[model samples]
Target: MSELCHQAGDARGMEDLMVDYYVDRPFFDELVGLFHERTLAETRAALEGGVEWIFANCYYNSLSAGWSPAIFREVFVPHLRAQVELVHRYGARLDYYDDGKLDASMELIADCGVDVLETCTPPPVGDLDLRRAKARIGAQTTLKGYVDLLWVVKHGTPELVERTVAEAMEIAKPGGGFIIGSSDCFREGTPPENMHSYFQACLNYGVYD
Candidate 1:
């Protein structure tokens, strides 16, 4: 969908349409409605199966999707709130995942009652400043994933992995809401030694007294 939107060269206009359901209100209604319908059904099914976590991976990264604050507040926040409510009603948590810049949407994500927000990708690949994210929304939502999976994890040395993990832990570990994880998946060709270093560093720095 993102690819199609970008290919159409109207991503921002797409966001604007979401702002008002502009071009076709009924179409937009059905589209957003479909999302809620399917999402709620799956949430119910997962909870009934006794799962404790509902990882809702919305790949429409707000930054890349051309989301403005209006798009978030007016378009996405309500649906996310509904998602959180349904999940919490069943004694489950919603871990929302979006794989692009998250700096601007962190507060709104937390405000929508999401329990966990993953892949809070930091700069170069993403724009999240972990220290600020920790300060702002850390009290409300669990801050997950800041390591650069492609660079520091897959391509870089074990020493770099350990250093990255250590730096992340130093900032996000203090208050206990952070999870040391990758910005995205460890892709194919990721070094096994790097994986080892990642966990070793986790144990080394992520241990809480």
Candidate 2:
């Protein structure tokens, strides 16, 4: 990744590769501000590099602790909008990833022209009503995911998992846009039996026919 960054003659080439490194480091206020600045700078560089799609990740767990809508609008939204616009200017699409409650951020996300919004978490934290999200975002944006990962798989029985998957398919799969998967990253402690049950459910219930 460092080699790629060097080859491209800019930091943008290695932006994705830096994710792990950033994860390991501590987050300070100065660093947080720097993070946003670097994101905008790298996004512009990526657009200039002939990239076709830009994956934009919004706030993670921090939103749950009350990163209010006003704070996002005043501080973060403009930078995100700029990134989306820069990508669009280069004929690319933006996919914004936010697993937190997006009720506050939806308008800003839409305003940024996000082509795809991944509702990667389930209800309470995210829009469990995939249909409503689609309606709200309208036809211009594609809605993806709303599966209850922790509830259906980790705690539920195999039969329950199967039933949940069947229900999810009935609601989320009728249309052409949705994709079914874990609501968040599959955790290590998730039982193997539950994992097996989840995949079996997907296989048994995910078919169009």
Candidate 3:
């Protein structure tokens, strides 16, 4: 990878780097295998230290990385499946984090036996359809995060926060597989009143009965 970048010259753009290092590269499989091995080692160490959940942050979201369904199924899925198996063997849950355009890959991740899928970013900022996701993979995987932190949480009114939370609850809360949270961590300047409303709405609608 470094060699490719060096050959491409310092002024080469991100597109050049992406093509050289990721897309159709001869060393892709070898690099992926090495990363998988390192991740497994880290997961094992964390589990041995009594971690209850393994957070696997996959940087290969298809929207930006241009990964095809074939590449995802053939190359990535097996690595994810192995991680799930290893985590389960140690009695720990695996939380797969890919905070972008999950609609393309959500089912495949769930099918890998992952316990939780994080940051189900909704439309505009991302393309995840929470309703579709809930109906499809909710039974098998816990769906964490759908709230839009920037638009609805930070900038919108408290009423909007409640409404967003309520809407999410209506779709994903029924089957006991949803977790209401922001697209990412709540930003620094988010209004306190909205934060209160977000939690209050969760309490109001999150009740099972």
Candidate number achieving the greatest lDDT relative to the actual structure? 1
Ranked candidates, highest TM-score first: 1, 3, 2
Q: Poorest 10 consecutive residues of model 1 by lDDT?
A: 1-10
Query: In model 1, what is the error at residue 142, expressed in angstroms?
Result: 1.1
For lDDT, candidate 2 versus 3, the one ahead is 3
- Candidate 2's displacement at residue 135, Å, is 2.1
- The TM-score of predicted model 1 comes to 0.86
Instruction: Please give the lDDT score at residue 72 for candidate 1.
Output: 66
lDDT of 2 by residue, 1-209 (tens): 11121222133323432342346333323444465666767777887888888877554412443556775566456667776777788899987777767665676677778887775465755644655555666455766556666776776677777776777676666655555666677666777887888788788877666
- Model 3: how far residue 31 lies from native, Å: 1.8
Model 1, runs deviating above 4 Å: 1-21
lDDT values for all models:
0.80, 0.62, 0.78
How far is each candidate from the true structure, as Cα RMSD in Å? 4.2, 7.9, 4.7
Angstrom error at residue 149, model 1: 0.3
